[model samples]
Target: MNEHVPDPAAKLEERAKRKAAKREVKKTEIAASTLDALKQLGYANTTLRDIAAQSGMSLGSLTYYFTDKVELITYCVRLYKAEFIDRIEKSVTSAEGRDAVIDAFADELTRSMTEDLPTHRLWYDIRSQAMFDPAFRPVVEEIEGKLLETLTRVVQAAGQQDTSAVPLGYAMIDGVFRFLLQSRDRHARDNDELMAIFTAILRRIF
Candidate 1:
């Protein structure tokens, strides 16, 4: 029997892979920790030091993973919106019919607005900033495009062959969402109103 030997290059490569994986995990942990702070403070008011405090890490340590607030916020928002889209996709997929899809979508939207108001507000804040700062536009546009795609999927799953109305449908939904976010009385009545609007929009699209 011949003795097995580990290649030095392979060992080095494996170590590097582990290190990169560890770094990514740490970055995600930091992002999750700082998300609520960013949501509460808004992008303009937030800094890397603030994020560090939120993550319970020193500023120098935080800067090792993310150079600045913009980079950190961008990563945080992308991670959050990716999860948000995943939820919408899952809800839409589980519904069996057109009406069910519409209801699921509307219910999810209502749940998100009512339960995660601060996060949604942060999203809008970043979107508004994108108008004046080019740095924010790419991520903003990417997220909006994904959201539109989700809306389109919802429409198509609802048996709407004429997809021309999808864009208008998305705009209607977004407008309602933004309006509700700013509304002071976020009672069940507001949710009921949103459900009604969503039903009407879905029916019209179909």
Candidate 2:
């Protein structure tokens, strides 16, 4: 005769998994509401109370997750970080080595800029602060460093190795990013024209 025994290890693992799932759900709720509040009111104008209210949670709850507004913005920066790299990487890969990589990049840049106005505004808002806010420098630097690395990889894959042109290549994209984000509210800009500019500059650099 054999006796059945309960697996203590399996039972403990299941409990741990349930707790982790609950924590993840709570974190997702907070991040979603936090991002919504930022999109609506922007960084400087948005407050903890506003986030708590929008989230349907108490101020204490918001504080429990994030010590302050700085932490919230830092979290947002981290959240969007992968997207930036992915967008660039996709643009580069989509064009293949023979197609105009710069034109493909411009398409990706235009897609986000034209379609995502709220985020466009948020970026400009943060960019405006980067000049005056010392605390924001590191966040900005982290983004810049990652973008440079991604572009460098693209250049390497395209059979280009001159690092000297990296800065120029970055300048091209930044100009396009800003133009799409900055001018559309007041003036009509042509996406094709922007693509032309990007392709022209990229060919020389690569």
TM-scores vs. true structure, each candidate: 0.90, 0.79
Local distance difference test scores for all models: 0.83, 0.75
Q: Pick the candidate with the highest lDDT.
A: 1
For model 2, residues 1-206, the per-residue Cα lDDT tens digits are: 77988799999999999998987678667877877888888888999899899899999988887788877776666566667679779777856663467667666766666666676577667767888987777887888788898888878767776777887888887776687567777876677765666666667667
Model 1 agreement with the true structure over 129-171: per-residue lDDT tens digits: 9999898999999999998888878878877777777778778
Estimate the Cα RMSD of every predicted model relative to the unseen true structure.
Answer: 2.0, 3.2
Clash pairs of candidate 1? none
lDDT of 1 at 177: 80
> Model 2, residue 83: displacement in angstroms?
1.2
Name the lDDT value of residue 14 in candidate 2. 97
Return the top candidate by TM-score. Answer: 1
